[model samples]
Target: MKHAQTFEIFLIAPPGLEQSLWKEARAKGFPSARYTTGGVTLKGGWEDVWRANLVMRGATRVLVRIGEFRAFHLAQLDKRCRKFDWAKYLRPDVPVRVEAVTNKKSKIYHAGAAKERVERAIAETLSAEISDEAPVTVKLRIDDNLCVFSLDTSGEALHKRGHKAAVGKAPMRETLAALFLGACGYDGQEPVLDPMCGSGTFVLEAAEIAAGMTPGRARSFAFEQLATFDGDAYAMVRATLPAPQRTSLSFHGSDRNAGAIENATANAERAGLSDNCHFRHASISDLQRPEGDPGLVIINPPYGARIGNKKQLFALYATLGTVLSERFSGWRVGIVTTDGQLARSTKLSFLPESAPIDHGGLRVKLFQTDPLP
Candidate 1:
């Protein structure tokens, strides 16, 4: 009897957030997990994969690397696919989708040809028909003359927890928001304030974590459709989830846009996290510190993509600097912006920081400030 094989967990983090993802993976009790530029690799079963998809905020998606082999040509790819133990993991009745990626040094550089070969191999090997529109997606990567096959345990990106009904104009993905929050060291034991909380994402993710909620409970994943899936095991693991802590974590968010406030409120409600999170209609000009243990303040203000101009937005940064400098002494701050000029106008020295995150093709930086002196 062959046992379930162990696979690597690929965590696609925002460009500058690798350390945060690695730190979170360790804190999740898989401390031995190794990390790389874009993600972390860990050992676990499907249950662990499911747990990672739900709880790992730092990861855009959690992928399970199932197969790795060298295939220099179409014949080699077909042979390798046929030799793979598809019967061990896939379900005959469940639909399957195969995706392929190619890079330099590969003769089979044409991705469409590779995808067709792999599909035919799977069909011929398993006597099953191929379907392009399956609910479950199997990912293939052929880079640097190496072919790696992985399963996207997360169906839609993990950010779409099936909750957020309303989104801001320059809305951030929930996964990216959580990862950014983690990068800023949001531990939930301390107050978290997002002055420019367009859709209340930073505050909401914080509230959920503070309340002891498992990010996966409120969502579903694609791995459940696999033939080898164990419902009993998953149910037991899920049953062990800690209850949402109802403490006053002081999760606060405000946006100048009235519509943004309303959207945040509705999003928080939909996430079942309204109790711990608060959204108000306010502006960066009106920010002040609240009395509590010193916590983190994160702002994803306008970066001139959808709102505000470079010159005009400097005023916004100046306002943010004034607000943080005056009221939130001793509170840590993180500001996301694309322009070094805009960051400089804040009048705060954010020395020794990494390059900006490349989100949507924009070079964005996470500027950190020293505690009030």
Candidate 2:
């Protein structure tokens, strides 16, 4: 994989949110981005890969396709892997892990055997150490006898973002929160609120987006350890990012748990979003409309699948609905939950439910309502 050559870059999306991730990629200036079953793909060089890791909020991780070949058998795969140019992307000094996945349609059905062959090739040919705990990873997918090799450029998942040190039970991931915010028509110009703000994921994400803060600004990437990495060039890329802007609008989050509020406030302070993110301890019944132009009110309440009882949650959902309906006029509502009955308990007129999304282990849907009348 030459540094100058453009190749396929894949952005892994959270199972059912591929289109949403693609939309974000396109809006971020990857005009030719296309959504596939599990991710979004585009053509880019190494710098584009770095940029994607640095700025893309909705991508779980970035993978860069280095090369591919067709191999019908293990011997053929071994021969091809040994002959392939491994030194172009991987460093001799850095350790790497090879992970392979093969499907029934492929003759190379044994993924473990394939992985061993590739590992041997890289170790012997490029002199790169192979370790199971390596920070850098080489991913291989063999389907229909074609082997595609990709590098996981983002070391930790992008959701880590290197800022939040605390999280609540059933917390929303930052990547999913960004996509859900986009689904609610949040363009970083309006206010956002989360009633059950666990560790303040939604509020902090909203404030960071509004301030134009790069998601990966505070983190390091796996690509930095690869052979193609250029420290001075990457520094220049980071330097060119637009300066964080100041915003007057405040993003609010409230929860009944005082500990949760403390965690949220600490998270905001760590992310440098304390200026625009306000967290308080309050229950659903005490939730009040913020004094501002009505923007968006999004919440990810307990689904009863992981916490609390389903029968008792009906009353909680009803109370949330009653509070929002009576107090939050002109504010759009986005509720994430696994049960249709719980969403309906709100009694707020919602637009059709979104396609089911995979969050944690549950299939959750975003139920949105137009601004409350």
Candidate 3:
């Protein structure tokens, strides 16, 4: 019963990274894409939804606007929900979970009550069961007396990427890593090094991008469970993406902890990027530039507030700056830290700092420099 028509597709971006994601969407041929507070919006069909989930590297998740209606009260909400063509997008055999949010302006102030009304209506009218563990989900948002419905086409946050099972404390998410790399103007043609690469996130992501691999190729999506899903057609669409290309350059990572290096190596192997990414145990004092074309050295070094003492961190940052400046001429640098003073202690002439980004509750920013002269 699902009809083919354009609908608003929301691609969620991390806070303060909306402009980077918008550029990515536009470069990927979604020319009509526009930035929003926490994401980018564009008009596309279900196929576009699948593609967005599969190809977008900077997006945390993709939501498709399924339908909308105005309901002033819970009774009207239930009445309108029953009339909705649930069969068009949901299968009777598959379980679904419904979540709702309500604003004070709406007559239905209780989100739990609104969710219960819709759940009952779907169960009775469509004969579908509700389960907390269901892969498919329906989301409702009521604001200013208008109710909007959306489907979370991405079941799990896209940052999982189905490859990185190991992580250390205060690790960066893959989505954020990609956005940071893109912000640095990484085109995947040059080498990338992460001196503090935990779990090999930046190194592995760089390798995958360099090889033209789709971020979601190794994973499944919630769209596969929808009633209108066409596995064969979707497979063809995936096939049409640019094939992986051979790269002469290699990505690199290093850490002082042997366990961290092991985890990074294992993660890279699992992502089938071990050949392109290499990891070793080394301290900042022992660091040396790898032999390759002048490319990028991107790192999320430890900050004062979380991992180490503020007083001691200044020496560490100064040492990093001394090493990169002496050994890495012609290579660009991107350092992520929460404290501006800590970043300044490095003595690296970083360009104007990027907008403060929210990383797990703390405000962080990236400070970069042009190729060292």
Candidate 4:
């Protein structure tokens, strides 16, 4: 098997949250990391790719640029792709899926045709079967007559951390939750409470971080099917992970729905974080600050656009603000909401707003407030 000493690695982030993800990548010691419009990029080896997939909390997917060439037409594209060393990068036994996109300036403008040509080249040169349902994917981009190929090393989206069997309506994705937690300055050392904790995403994520657990510990990746993958080396990478540290503080979550609390508790058990997290059935009006050093309180309340009526959500937000201000002073707060009016209804003195974040097709912003006086 052949491996490049260093190749381009792209980590996809949610729109408007690239800076947060970039900060995370840099803090993780990817010195070469820099943010693009939709993601961050770095130059790294296969091991770095493996590590990113296994450890990055904010990345939605990790892609590796394999190779590229300039070709104006289909025949040229086919000849060049065949000449490229497919066998060195792909395994003969693993089925592959190919996807392509082209710009207007490219002579090979048909995306379907381009994908078919590349698929045929791989099949002929490496004897790899092509399947639409294949776990491994080859992505192609033809812009200004230049062809670029990349591999989606992340099979399932990273947000599907392989533990939660139950999810609530408008459930926040784990990647998005991690980025929000980072934005709110939650470093896992302090206790966190989510008053509207629908499936306990915020609470569980905070617990995992506080416990020093890697988000990918429960999941697998697509790189395992590639020809260059070294199982033994990858096993060493996993083995070398520092043990998860014990946390002194417990995370708390509450929801009005008894079923949601039950689901959240079950999800915590499945993630092996029940000991560090506690879930209860309580509404926002009933919430009282847990006795501890003041920490962070974050919530993803019911958004008007996704679930409830806007008028109804306003009162809910206002009530939330009233409860937090009256009972949870000294705790910093972060709320994720789509409607600015709804966020304002909280009446909590918020700091400057965050960039609009894309969550489940709705634009949401994080509203933060300093420790209440």
- Among the numbered candidates, top lDDT falls to 2
lDDT (Cα) of model 1: 0.79
List, residue by residue over 1-373, the lDDT tens digit for candidate 2.
Answer: 3367899999999988999999999998898799999999999888899999999999999999999999999999999999999888999999999999999999989999999999999999999899998989999999899999999999999999999999888889999999999888898988999999989998998999899999999999999999899888888888988899999999999999999999999999999988889998999999989998998999999989968888899999999999999999999999999999999999999999899999999999999999999
Q: Against the true structure, what is each candidate's TM-score?
A: 0.93, 0.98, 0.97, 0.97
RMSD of each: 2.1, 1.1, 1.4, 1.3
Per-residue lDDT tens digits of candidate 3, residues 158-232?
998998888988889999999999999998988999888878899998999999888998899998999979888
- The list of candidate 3 runs beyond 4 A from truth reads none
How displaced is residue 112 in candidate 2, in Å? Answer: 1.2
- Model 4, stretches more than 4 Å misplaced? 1-4
Q: Of the pair 1 and 4, which is ahead by TM-score?
A: 4
Error of 1 at 340 (Å): 1.8
How much lDDT does each candidate structure score? 0.79, 0.93, 0.91, 0.91
Superposed Cα deviation of residue 297, candidate 2 (Å): 0.5
| Segments in model 2 whose C-alpha atoms lie over 4 Å from true places | none
lDDT of 3 at 88: 90
